[model samples]
Target chain A: MARWLLISVIYIELIIVSLGTSSVAQGGQELDWAALDWKALDWEALDGWELEGEAFAQARYFPDNPLYIGQHSQNQSLALELSAYRKFSDSFSLEFIPFYRHDFQDDERSHLDIRKAYALWASPTLEIGAGINKVFWGVTEAVHLVDIINQTDAIEAPDQEEKLGQAMVSLSLPLPSGLFDLYLMPNFRERNFPGEDGRLRGALVVDTNNPLYEHKDKDHHIDWAARLKQSLKDGELALSYFEGTARDPNLIMPLGTPSPVLLPYYSQIKQLGLEGQYIKDEWLWKLEAIYRKGQPNLQFEVEDYYAMTGGFEYNIYSIFESSQDLGIILEGIYDQRRDNALTFNEEDIVLGTRWSLNNMHSTEVLGLWIQDADSSAHNFVLELSTEIGNSIAVTVEALIFSEQQRNSDSGRFTADSIGHQMRQDDYLQIEIGYFF
Target chain B: MRNNLSNPPFHFLASILLMIPLLVQAETAEQKGRAIFEEIDRRDLNFGDFSSDQEMILRNKSGQESRRIMENTVLEGGNKDINDGDKTLIIFREPKRIRGTALITHAHQQRDDDQWLYLPALGRVKRISGASKAGSFVGSEFSYEDLAPQEVDDYTYEYIGDEIFAEQDCFKVKRVPVDKDSGYTQQFVWVDKSEYRIQKVEFYDRKATLIKILTITSYQQYLDQYWRPGYLSMINQQDGKSTDMIATNYVFRQGLTEADFSENSLRRAR
Candidate 1:
């Protein structure tokens, strides 16, 4: 608790310094900010034009948990991200970002290190990009929290993968009734294992803001996507489909006899998913379902998995009169996995509330209840974050578990199997960051 | 019931007689206003030589303002090929910080319009696109289409009625858009009856909202034949911003030939 308090004080001090200096500079006459001139030029005047470049900086900090019990200690880290962007034309631009980090903890194991980059080109009808970029899927605010997954470990859950290399292209074509967009992507890089070869993916994305049915008007819209996915949103979903040769198959087996080696080939592993969403004014509701076929080989047999998720999010306005926009989200997910080695079924109900306090401050609190056919568990998470200015943001998060499942005990045929035993673990993390 | 209704016939006749004069006055006023509006719409004002000083102010939603001063010179002619080519030069004087930037717009009715913008920072001139004559100059309330010299044949006008604006008796006229994709659905203008100059205009957006209001003030006649407004102010109701153009100097009857409005001439004008 003492250490957490110390980190919080330091974080607040740094923010005050940065914001005070920025405000002073802006108030002075040294910098000239010009308003846009609307009538000086003709139509198509901005087409094929480029603007001069400017430089900026950003910094952030995450503090330790203030409330917890038993061996409570906080982990804190700070990172700086620098970026530059240049527009070659109205349709094309290039961007570069570089980042560095430092952790306050004495142990080197708790430190963070990463390098990430991406580029994008956009036109009226086409968009293309390559590098380690983040893509979001699903439309529901609560159920799609899984889609908001970030690659950087310093900013996201420690267990999550931060970056992956991929190339993608998307094109939008206007149709008589509406518009149609097609997207294709191929991911060739992995974070923790040898890069997989001979694996490619594609998706068809259709977005329409126009009315689909005669009874509906332009305000009622829909977005749909069909994707060929080799990886799931969460790593837990990858436990299924064990066929297809791994780049390092030996990494999975016990270190004794020769690990089974399979020829490089394409194995059939497929999943079909559909999501429908309806948004009207302040009300939003969504339903989603996915089913995947398991792949099996001689050494290990994987499982088939299916899951359905439904949720609604409502923005509450009359609650806080000033500086805060609050919203409540409710979601439920049911998942089932069946295989020769094991069969597991689970259902999760999550309730969360998010508060956006002006442009500079925001916080979210979530409670998760998991009911397994074999056991039950509860998890609670709270995150508070704020953007100090244009360049700086800070976040602190805490996660607590009532009954946890460990990887070593989650499988079949063991005394410590997840079905027969239970354990609990709590994690607290703090991060401070700067960007330029 | 039939006997009672027949007893009130004399009272009904008295009410009808009372309304006749009111209706006649309304019809006569509309007729007089329409005639004046049609006369102004039919004549195309020819420009000989003109110069004016303008003050421009750019503001944001937060009510912050930036001001600029500019000078303009134009040599205009009619459709009879009297001055087939002529040039208009606009120069910025103050704030002295942006004094060296200039814009030269040349008009050639036979071909396309050409313009050049000269920047002091780059010390070079660049050609501007003519295809954008129908588009907004800068995300502003006035589009490039509004900046073009009003051609007599470009629009068909209808006189609506008489109205009082800023204590001036004005003729109200409605202009239907000829271009299909014009940002405005229709424009309503109130022209001063005596001066034959536009006193006020209400621009209706595609959504049928009163998006922009333009008012003309301080008029000065040039060369005794051309009545020019010294100040024109446009207020964007939605964005809370206004642009005010104020003319300071005037010169008439400058000899400018048609050859000056060509693209080849734009490169040489600077």
Candidate 2:
């Protein structure tokens, strides 16, 4: 009799709970962070087209350009990225992304290009793809030193996050404990650099159209890359090798240019990169190292060198009872060919932080400070991104440069050095993107 | 009934005699609760593998809501090793930007669970460290720990008592997580003895306060022997947030093998 009575009471309570839930479900509150209905939207607007605008201002100027060339930069730009995608079945798909940008300050920065045009076929354990595509490798937060698959899209961004897609046929096969990918790239694309009129350009501007190549086949030479990656329970590792014309061009002075103009020259190169990361509790240890042959030295010789970037990241969650996370990232980079390497971050330390507010807006902020070991230069960058609504995104970035240590840089960028060239180009950028 | 009892209960005497073995087998509340849990696990061990499409709806205070659709495939434990837990893959399909994100988890009883996240943007597999089980799943109320395959040895149980809940006879049990880094200190669960299926659970946070309450309903039996809940909803008592997970479809025995759950398959899971 007691059991039956309790059952009746429990049933009553459950009905009350159900009623309460139903009322709330039908109440006045609105949806937050809801997945915007992608299926209901027009396919052409949702997947085919995107529009973006950017505003930029230089905070400081290098002494040489404004006085001699009278170049002062305050610029606005518009960009459009068009993508076409189709899926025939679970086994086949196609994608194409073409972007066009127009900059008011530099006409060279305004152009149309295709980033990717790829077709893919996949089985359960194997996949094959062909056409122009972008592939990224490495696992470091501060600097992606080992991600060398694609040439940089110089005018697109200063952070080196954007790339010009490569044309290749690739295959990925599953290993018992890892994944192996093989790529046969038949087209080589030279890197593009900012023009003289651009604020972020080097002191002597780069000639984008004209370039020399060590290989007689030049841009036609086929390049190849292979990677084997394994994912463990709490760690990951990858070994990748690339043989092709160097993506980073060596600057050579042309006969016509009196000012030390940089003519891009590609050289033969072979690189082997190893990347791995392991996580322990709240701390993550990341490492990326590469050994390369055929990087042009100071004497324009194919010299061999090694470089590495290692770091750790630690984060604190639910800060101050709010669903936010603050993460601290630290990494140190060292290069065996201190001044002969392609990048300016030789023997440097990077300190950065990431802030993520777990909110409906999906807001995030990242700031990084990279300082040279000799205390000659400092590079500081800050980026903040958030969604404006369901279909738009807004981002703001600031790049600041400190005093350059004259003649301290050991890299191939010795003439202008990355520090001095960027010192006067310190600028703030604001960009907004509409997805549909 | 009175006449029957007047005979000193021939049926009652036999019932008491029948209870002797049970009394011997379960001396304490903890043992009895553990035995029931282990029995349920054993009965559930027969299922080999299954897949389903699911939608997870999250709501904050003031009734604001957000929804995400995903597909999940789970391989039953003991199909390979008796001590091994289930292998599961969750593929996010909706919220367009995060589409094609796949998380594969291989749960083990002896050590930490292995997890891999295949990022569509990066086109690479990322290891979500074992220690990250305490973190939330895609910013939802459910943590990786909450969704992990339940192994009998992962928690210790204490029988709270028998009670009628949801119009059915139920066993109330308190379960304390044995994993040192568990976000919850203890959880109180309601299980219906008739089907040996979970009906409700109340989660206590690290501070041992009631943090979340989960209620399951719309149970449908598959293959005549497997009872699968159609919907599971969790409400955060402290934050007024909630998550409702509803399974839309299910397919059993697709001939999934251990290789299918491997990290290499994650990138191809779509």
Compare the candidates by TM-score and give the number of the best one: 2
Error of 2 at A84 (Å): 4.4
lDDT per residue as tens, model 1, A1-436: 2223323543454466555545654786675233112332221233333222212222222233322122124334444444334455544554333444443432222223223233445543445543333343344433332231122231224323343222334343433212333444332222221111100000111111111221122111121223322211110010111111111111122234353322221123355555555443344566667565543322245556566777776655323322234667777766554222221223557677766542212233433333433344555667776544333445566655555433334354321132222132255545443332
Model 1 chain B weakest 10-residue run by lDDT:
B261-270
Model 1: per-residue lDDT, tens digit, B127-160?
Answer: 4433344343322334555655554434446778
Please list all clashing residue pairs in model 2, or write none if there are none: A339-A410, A339-A411
State each model's CA lDDT, in order: 0.45, 0.75
Residue A270, candidate 1: Cα error in Å is 2.2
lDDT of candidate 2 vs native? 0.75
Chain B TM-score by candidate, in order shown? 0.72, 0.89
Candidate 2 residue-wise lDDT, B112-147, digit = tens: 777778885455566655666666665567777888
| DockQ for each model | 0.02, 0.16
